[model samples]
Target: MSFTTRPEITGTFGVATSTHWIASAVGMRILEQGGNAFDAAAAMGFVLHVVEPHLNGPLGDMPLLMRKAGDAAPTVICGQGPAPAGATIAHYKAEGLTLVPGSGLLASVVPGAFGAWMLLLRDHGSLPLRAILEPAIHYARHGHPVLPRVAHTIAGLAEFFETEWPTSFATWLPGGKAPAPGSLFANPDLADTWERVLAEAEVAPDRAGQMEAARLAFYEGFIADAIDTYLRDACVMDAAGGRRKGVMTGQDLADWQATYEDPLSVDYHGWTVWKCGAWTQGPTLLQSLRTLSGIDLGAMDLNGAEFVHTVTEAMKLSFADREAYYGDPLHADLPVSTLLSAEYAEARRKLIGATASRAQRPGHIAGLERWAEAAVARAGRDLAAGPGVGAGEPTMAHLTERRGDTVHIDVIDRWGNSVSATPSGGWLQSSPVVPGLGMPLNSRAQMFWLEEGFPTSLAPGRRPRTTLSPSMAEGPDGRQLAFGTPGGDQQDQWQLILFLRLVHGRMNLQQGIDAPLFHTAHFQSSFYPRATKPGHLMAEPAFGEDVLRDLRDRGHEVEVAEPWTVGRLTAAQRDADGLLRAAATPRLMQAYAAGR
Candidate 1:
């Protein structure tokens, strides 16, 4: 057997994995306390907001995939907030903006993560509201060791925050300086906020009512009041290099709530893989799988040039479709059925050849050619811009100045309940702190186009096609799997690669996660400036020079990443025999899996 960075955690009781050890521990603690996977996942989600503040926050968005013990398939919990009523292409253009500023009040969306978690707890969780939030409040008030990357991200934006976003400066830099790496850092304001929410929730006198009370406290109560007051007159510097006020209001918060939706699924080689819906970039993975189903992936070496090239090419095609057609289904006529159809996949698969193609190619469906054309036109436009002062999602260190990304949580309890959630957007750099709330607004609005007639066009009350995707699957042997990663555009890409290895290459959970990872940035990014790198493929150095050379020979613009730096993935699964398994990437030495 090949060596893995760590053993795949195995247990008969429960397992949890996350981007941070503290969050994973919190989840395990919940499980140990007799809470189910939903309860544990809710606790982990809140704790992650505290510990990985630079990566995610209360105001961020999340796409969760959850399966109850007896359920045949996982369901989706969409924590993604929509564009505010005042958010529109006309208003943005009037502000002299072509694209929504990647950072700043102008890019604010209705905060959804908090509401989503509350919804998850209310519907599926058995724990009390206070039990789920206590850990996060503790970390925020008492303090947790600040991650080095968090410090570096704060330092990079220190000057900008101090000068342009003094509110952010005051919050992130308490003593007028970025906290030193590993230093105990606390956000008393955030702690106080949660404490107040809890106090209000407790008035309901029961778990279910308390959960609803907490939701109201955040959406229609103090949380919304604070955000509304902050954005009212605060014209702050944004990623577009301009000062702008926001359009979000308390009413927007009052109008929005996290909802549940059916997951989109596709069967591949006896496994039924599930993803959050077309509203996110989740369908891209399904599309990739459909395309790959026609190919014999098992015939190629998992880490060799042939495997890398084939997967990369398939991803480019899938992501190309993402740019063209994937958007909030509530607002657009998405051709999801056709996009995931077997015939369409076969047709698209024919386009993949021995050489890399640099073109942006979204498949043409009858009558949907306009969307595809719009995608090509938007991608072709030369919008020469760089990531504004804290404007992009946390991705690879080399990919953005703000090296923070998103966070993923995977949990499975003894009862067979499971959750895979990817939460992101309200990074420390996304926007200024909302004064009293101790968290910034999400910049998800930047994912919407300012142009009209496209599914992703900026519109009030529409969910931005988010890159925050979580995944679940059921194997032929009846093992239920919950898996996901943190990279924005690369979330599904990295997940697709790992799933393939686990299914075809016969690697254990840890082996698949620890294996050298790779992804292509050959499609328009979902973040600010929306840059596209044609034929670009980034792989970890562990893939070896020979494989890299082979990729280059196939016309891939291969860039070798630092050893163990490609993906931040975590996974958990419940086998048919009642055993639980979990694993996390050792790429950044941050992610951890906890199980007996």
Candidate 2:
């Protein structure tokens, strides 16, 4: 066995893992109180919104993959909100943006996460909405220890908020200064927001009625009213280096609701991996697995140069396809069947050469090549001069930026139910906070394209092709797992590596998560500015000199990153013997796992 920073948590009763220790503990607390996995996850989800405000918030997007006890298949709860009716390509262009700004009002989307959590609590969870929200309410009203990174992020943005967004200034700089790290930071407004929702919910006689009432409170009542009223009059500086008013209206908020959908899956080796459909970047991992299925990865050294090269090359090809084909399937004719076929993988696999390729080589789908070619051309020209500045999604950074990505949670209950969710979008830096709500609307609209030709083009009521991807899989040996990470485009790349290590290398959860990680930046970023770096591959320095040298020899633009800074992944698993296992990456020192 290899040295791991922590033991793989094993329990027969329940397990919950999340990017924040407080959220993980909340979930376990719920489970200890006999709440099922869905109930525990809902509780933990709310806690994450309060405790990890820099990483995620109530206004962000979340896609959940869940399985009921004894069910063979997992279903997706799509919390990703759609573009508002006023969010058209023409309006953005009229606002002088060729791309959506990374921050401010114009980039805001209908807040979906609040309603989504309510949905989970309503349909799948057993606890009352009040019970599910208690931990978050307490944390928000009283206080929680502020993460140092959160403090740093706030400090960096203090000037921006004070100068351009006074509402944000009041919320973040309570005393005209950023909250000190380790200080008890409270958002009494956020707590009041939840309390109001709970108050509205209590008027209902039962759990189902209460859940619906809470949803209404967020989407139709005071929350929506405050967001709409605030946005209508407010215009602030955006990524285009200009100030702009938002296009979303109260009608948009009232019109949107979280929906459940069938999950997309692909069989690899002996296990079946599942992800949210094309609407999210989840399918990118599935496509990478398909491409890798044709390769004999077992024969390669798990941490050696060849393995890294092959995996990175495969991901490049898959993400290239992602740029070309994947989108909101509701709006686009995504040839998912052809894309996932073995023959197509074989054809795409040939593009993986001995050296790294600089081109964004999207495959030629016979009937869809015109669309594919157009997307490829646009991708090539779409490269941002550099990363988007200011508040944006939980983004991947080397050591330069203090910006973090998203938050992830995986929960498995004693009853055998499981859920994996990636929640992101609303960050303190992303947009100005709604005055009364103490949370900013998500900037997920930045994921949409301003140009009119692609499936991801900004359209009324269409979901942005989100990068918030969660994962679930069933191993051949009857081990079921839920895992995900928080790098914008790197979510799947990190997940694929961990899964391969778990299934093929026979590594336990911690071992797999702790393994050195790497990802390519050859494709356009999903966030605003949409930067791309041809042949770029970032690896943890712990991967050592030989692996780095081999990758460099293969023509990769290799950059060594600080150790334990690449992937923030967390996972929970249940084995055939009914034993539960959980692990979280030690990379960020923020993630934690708790169980028996």
Candidate 3:
């Protein structure tokens, strides 16, 4: 029933990913060639935009956090854009808005990738921006396989081909059509942007200037003005708005701007973790992980009833916090101080059972009595599922979820330093195109609370809480580990479970990442809904009633998940001798790790 936590090995390790394994290989080469972790990670983060445009783009938001071995202080950066100060919650209310098309388009925030990446390089990277960007530039110009995931998403959104702003896809396509998987694709416009970023980095070589150029090229240039005109002219968004109708006006493009800033995070059970601040649901991940820690997770097998019950109860406890206090930390007085406190962790842990899990959370923390009451009031009720529900028909149950635009790259070098990063190309599927620019305007403005006066409502310069969290963990023995995922809300538990599997079960990086995973949406704010209820677990349907019985004894809802239900992307442990291993969920196609 007990699993032992093993010590982490030492050596250079790196994990970087593009939608394609080629980019992943490129980063591994950099690491082996003696580039630091940041350089390796930056290479992967930039190139994914070229190979996986439909999922992520240069136009979207980025949230990044990192820590070095034995370093008490951790640095955090936000890669997400902000709502224009002009975009108030009042805007949605005034317009009688029911929904916004893409979360990236809804974004009023300024894009922060330029600044965030520089900060990473400035502190952790060894090579110059020029050196780090070389790989991406090559990939952008030369091209790689049209991943099935990428091709499918773009084909589904073919309307984008006709949108007001020029799509870079056409440039990559050459024949003016999507290339089939395995066909070569290239991005000339992004190549130009890549050149500009490199030129800026060469000229100023400072974080502020280099990053600002990256921002300005997309926002204030011919691209931005045209898109502004289009949005103003069109009023409504669709493919024809650009090429056929000429509807979106330059004025609308002018109105569009990417947001930027350092998003907030908190410690759960004394370990540093990241969240998607105000606009997106990031804190819910932190709260659930902390709550889960209180239970005796090893009481049953990984898929057994007891394990499921304890996990779900903890999820319910944390859900209360997410629903109540999980908003932009700056906009409100979240009880984060108390939520992560030892007293609350212990209190939250006490409500679980080895037999049957409760379908709800307990008001264990004193300050959260109000939240507890609310949960009690709403007990047995299900929080509404967000957009993109019932999208499992496509490959990997990700038709909606896999419209992915975020990328994660983590690196640890032989020098005992590590870097964790998550970057974005604005959501290609939903963001509007400015007339001249090939990039899409971020639509994260939609992540704001649709209702009036919600804590996450848009305001001047306020950052949207996002699911784009990049995190690093250090073992109790000073051995270091870092990882992040693209699964929206599952980023938290998915990464947490992976970390625990390696530490608690002593699995290697691949085995740990490849292992079956379970989660409970009950009472928790998931990027996806359809939470597990009492007596259910989203597990491989291989375990027997004995496992379920044990979970019931602990008050869990253990449901059978299709085997291989989850595996978010990961970049960790730099060298094989070290922990630098890349682990994509086995469920995902063509995901693997490479290190030298």
Which regions of candidate 3 deviate over 4 angstroms? 1-20, 32-34, 68-70, 99-104, 159-176, 205-234, 238-286, 353-402, 523-537, 542-562, 569-571, 574-584
lDDT of 2: 0.86
lDDT for model 3: 0.54
lDDT value for model 1:
0.90
Model 2 weakest 10-residue run by lDDT:
385-394
lDDT tens readout by residue for model 1, 266-334: 999999999988999999999999999989999989999998899988999999999999899998888
Backbone clash tally (model 1): 2
Candidate 1: lDDT of 529?
82
Q: What digit string (tens of lDDT, one per residue) describes model 2 on residues 5-115?
A: 899999999999999999999999999988899999889988988888888889888998989989999989999999999998888888777888887787878878877
Tell me how many clashing residue pairs each candidate has: 2, 1, 100
TM per candidate comes to: 0.99, 0.98, 0.79
Give the top-scoring candidate (TM-score): 1
Model 1 / residue 469 / CA error / Å = 0.6
